[model samples]
Target: MSSATKYTRGHATFNVISKAILAGFATACLLPFILMIIGSFTDNTTVLVNGYSLFPEKWSLAAYELIFKYPKQVIDAYKVTIFVTTVGTAIALTITTISGYALSRPTFRSRNRIALYLYFPSLFGGGLIPWYIMMTQVLKLSDSIWALIIPSLVSTYNIFLVRNFIRTSVPLELFESAKIDGAGELRTFGQIILPLITPVTATVGLFIALGYWNDWFLSNLFITTSSKYSLQYYLYNMLNSSKALQELKAISGDISIEIDLPSETAKLAMAVVATGPIIMLYPFVQRYFVRGLVIGSVKG
Candidate 1:
């Protein structure tokens, strides 16, 4: 009968309803991935006949077996991708944050001009032929791992996101206070600014990591040696090879070619392998990602 009791009941009902809705949404999001995983394990013939399903009539490891047929190559690709993603993300995050902090500081008189310089390239680019020449002929980065790392190390969009987040979420007075305490720019940034911008940094780091992880074009363009291929590129090559084999079989009309390439299942398997590590990484940064997006999106 009391107002407090009614309020409590209403709040409890809202919580239950909200939780149920979120649960349903989460399940819906996960369903496709779950089916893909299951389909990867299902017999290729069964999958071809039945399409993808939660419950497959027949089970098989043909796809995984084919993928791991050259375990060394797969392992090497994994190593390359992991190293690139880790090192590239760290370096990119450092550069972006530092650039953003510099831009955000009102005392930096040339920030506007510098920002214009950074933003201009993003708007217009010299054609691919020139870019290729610059990388291969000018930089001499061909067949080198650095080729992959250097090209995408800094993103203009990410830099601006961090700059905006710092300007809006962080107070200018804090910088002045640090200066008064005899803190050098480096010391002040490390101790004060870095801590306040954790959410934005994590978000930017995640974006950089994903970009590095998913990048296949860089490897295709710059890398000639098979050993240096990143995971995405390696998988892309494998898929191409599989399709080639299928095409050859179709042309030959030879039922005895014995080319049992699990193309569809192999695709599913590749997705699982390539995405598994990055998917695991999401939960650790999920909270920061959401908070950063909110804080960064608010117009200063």
Candidate 2:
């Protein structure tokens, strides 16, 4: 009957209720994706007949088989995507962190002006033709993997986020102390600043990785050779070709040839295949990502 016991019970009850609510919302968000995966495994005929039920009458692996039939193409695309994502993320993080740290420093005389210059492009960008000419005719990066990695190497928005995070998260006294201890700029940045802003670093890194992984437009514009296609572009071309084949069959009545086209189920399977590996990365970094966003937003 004590007041303290009642307060503990009430707080515990509220906490449980909150967790249950969040769990429900999470399930709600996840259910459609789960159903999409299950639907992909379901037979194409069953999907056509039943219209995408979670529990279908038949199961098939036709979609996955179709994808892996071109093993060399798929593997090559995977290598390209992995290389671009890894290299792009590393380069992006380095540039963003360095620029951010410099901008966060009070002693940097032109930090504000340089920040404005960086921010300007995000608000106003040159038209597509100019950029295309610049990349192709000027830089001559077409038909190469460099085209994908180079253009998106730096994000002004990410730089500002990191700058704000560093300004608000790290104490000014730490920098002064490091300077007094005879540490050079590089030494202080490497030994002191980098370690302190790990959360934000990981957060920005994840963003850059996702951007690189999901990018297909850049590939469409720059890549002419099939050998250089990224995974997203490969999948996009796969889906488009499949659709075109279906249309050809419908229009030409090509039952004589017996062509096998990818169904709706197959498209869903492609999505799962393309996205599954990248999705696995989120769980490993989810904690830091959430914490980083909270600290960055609240502190800034």
Candidate 3:
């Protein structure tokens, strides 16, 4: 065979192998979400009894009916979650951006020390007991929306991401030119840096939004009242109350239990409601996020 033909065949084989590897990785990443979506619709009794099934053999809308029946709880949860996600993302992004920009400035002497002060918390969260006591006894944050907001406002990882992105991407000349034109740091940051960093900002903001939206741990611990539960916490109760029901049944054995628990279908509906907007909006944001990474190449 000719050398040219052999090289062409090798290139074709390499391309095919690369595509197959990428496809496999994509499938691995997507399979869990697909299972969750499918499981939400599958008969829970069947799933509990016979592992997860790809398709629902016995379908029912009972779960959705139950959620709709007590729509007040779900609606309230949505309100709280939306408020938290929006406000939390806004506050987090603002702080992260400002801090990151300040830290990225080469002349800042306290940047490293301040970064350590912020970053150390992520490595070891004060154990729940001490943290809880601090928030509740010391700070009096229990039973308030501030419980969620305050704890999550400053993420060490976010600060680092913003700082690195700013350092690697944002142009120094732009800041210099702005300063030479007599623009103060705050004005330059507000008007110039912020506009240019929208891509990274959007990326970080979306991450914060998702974190707040999907958070159940904070609500579960901090909120004792029904009215204060976020969507994830409320949905969690609706989705997984089977264990509690089982315990109740075991306690009072030999009696027919008829507590209306959320059904598999309703779980699917809830999942859809929870993630629908994010999935819809991600494509738009992703476009810019990609551009941000691409545009912000190495800085000297």
Scored by lDDT, the top model is 1
Per-candidate local distance difference test:
0.87, 0.86, 0.79
lDDT score, candidate 2: 0.86
Q: Which prediction has the highest TM-score against the true structure?
A: 2
lDDT of 3 by residue, 183-300 (tens): 9989988998998877778778877787898899999889988888988887787667855776687898834664564555566678766776777887777775565455444332
Model 1, CA-based lDDT: 0.87
Question: Model 1, stretches more than 4 Å misplaced?
Answer: 1-31, 48-53, 254-264
Stretches of candidate 2 above 4 Å error? 1-28, 48-50, 255-260
1-300 per-residue lDDT for model 2 (tens digits): 455665677888997999999999999999988987998788888888889887789999986787677678878888999999999999989999998889989999999999999988778888889999999999999998999999888888788888998898799999999999999888998999999988889888888888899999999999989989999998898788877887787899886533556668877887888888967877887787677667656745
Better of 1 and 3 by lDDT: 1
Task: Score residue 152 of candidate 1 by CA lDDT.
Answer: 84
TM-score of each predicted structure versus truth? 0.83, 0.85, 0.80
